[model samples]
Target: MKTIGLFAVIMSAAMTVQAKQVAPTSSKISPATIDQAIRLAEATSKEGVTKKITIVTTDNGKSTDVSPRYTVYLGYNSMAEMGNISAAYLIAEDAYSNVTAKRLAPGIYQVQYKAYRDEAGMVNVTKVIDANEAFINDNEIRKACADDFCDGTIKAAVDVQESTTSAN
Candidate 1:
């Protein structure tokens, strides 16, 4: 009985360790897929067609009209002192728009935009704005953005603008 009890305890301990060691599976979707889905969803829904979006950067406190140039791309941050951190999503309102790529250090930023629906129930137009390094820290760039920097200020600004505009 004593041996059986000890064996059971050891098995349970081993199972617990194995469970802890299990790696999480990735649920990551590619940018192209996301873009396609957004486009498709917009095409299917009349409400999504006329939905306007506004992107605002909290760092500069200046808002630009970005409706005619909605394009998304991969971006990287390079600093002379800090070196290059990681790649991030870069959405723009224009193909020729200039993003202040070099000056942005570790900081928080906001991008706001509006999309207008066309007669075919598609989001034919979108307005996008970008801000670089509105907030930054020395941790993993992607992880940091996902956790702390992306949500608080940027989301608040977006929410406030959306609410105020929708009300008006």
Candidate 2:
């Protein structure tokens, strides 16, 4: 089992992918590079794979102003799904409300967001649901307006899936 800096690769590939039009664009990343990235997961073994990603928060107890920051360090079991990361930011609860998340390190992430405050009875805009591996496996992220007390309205989201090819 080998560990790779997939986060770095993913970020770089992110830029290269943005310049494409379903027709090869003028990027340093060649078609072969993209193909290699797609095949990276197939070559790696998932035996010793472990992923530790945490979401630390502040002012979450009171339905006041909710802001969560983390230095995210994520270890994926496989790079099989690396291509979908570019679309990760596009995940949102509704057409009017959304979260913009960035991964800095394990347990270190910065999440700046907007919730539809005017969306009828949606005052509790400080609640967010805990997301774990299971939630991701289901391809959905859940958000809330409150906690144990009344726990605000429940909202769910799914990441858009797209593919980009690359290799280190």
Candidate 3:
């Protein structure tokens, strides 16, 4: 019995060493596919267009619009320093537009994405006016570890922004 077990172990190790790795597949993009993509994008854009941003916020127990053109802040302190994320831009009451949050701001991070959604069903994020840290952090972090953001200020800012956004 011991001899049979030893032989089995040796055979397993030899098989493991002989295993070969396979490379991932890559396919060429045909012009027809490219053209189709362009047409679809153009059509989607013509659906819903966002004219402007009218963010709702409460200040001193009063509701108001803080929809000034926002700066896409970069650098270490910027949104790029958060974590994995996802976001929806609130275009109107009961309406949300799909948006990709760039940087480390705690959501989906994709390079080379659809910059703007055609004016069809909703407005897409062409240029992010301003990102609220609270929304970013809240969506990104696990509720259990909410206080433990990778960086100190990122979580702190998110905490404050979320409180303010919810307050109104």
User: Lowest-lDDT window of 10 residues in candidate 3?
Assistant: 159-168
Better of 1 and 2 by lDDT: 1
lDDT winner: 1
lDDT of candidates 1 onward, in order: 0.27, 0.25, 0.25
Candidate 3 residues lying further than 4 Å off, grouped into runs, are 1-85, 92-128, 134-136, 143-168
lDDT of 1 by residue, 1-168 (tens): 999999986565331111111111222335443322121100112312121122211122224743333343323222222232333343433322222211122222222233332322222222222222222321334345543333221211110101101101
Q: Candidate 2's residue-wise lDDT over 1-168, tens digit each?
A: 123677765566542111111111122222332111111111222622223333222121223443322111111222223212111111123211232344533223333333332323222122222223333442221122111222111122322222223221
Superposed on all Cα atoms, the candidates' RMSDs to the truth, in angstroms, are 22.7, 21.6, 24.2
Using TM-score, rank the candidates from best to worst.
1, 2, 3
Candidate 1 regions exceeding 4 Å error are 1-69, 72-76, 80-83, 90-106, 118-168
Residues 46-116 of candidate 3 have per-residue lDDT tens digits of 31221111222111221254232221211112222323222223211211222123333322121111221
The better-scoring model by TM-score among 1 and 2 is 1
lDDT score for candidate 3 against the true structure: 0.25
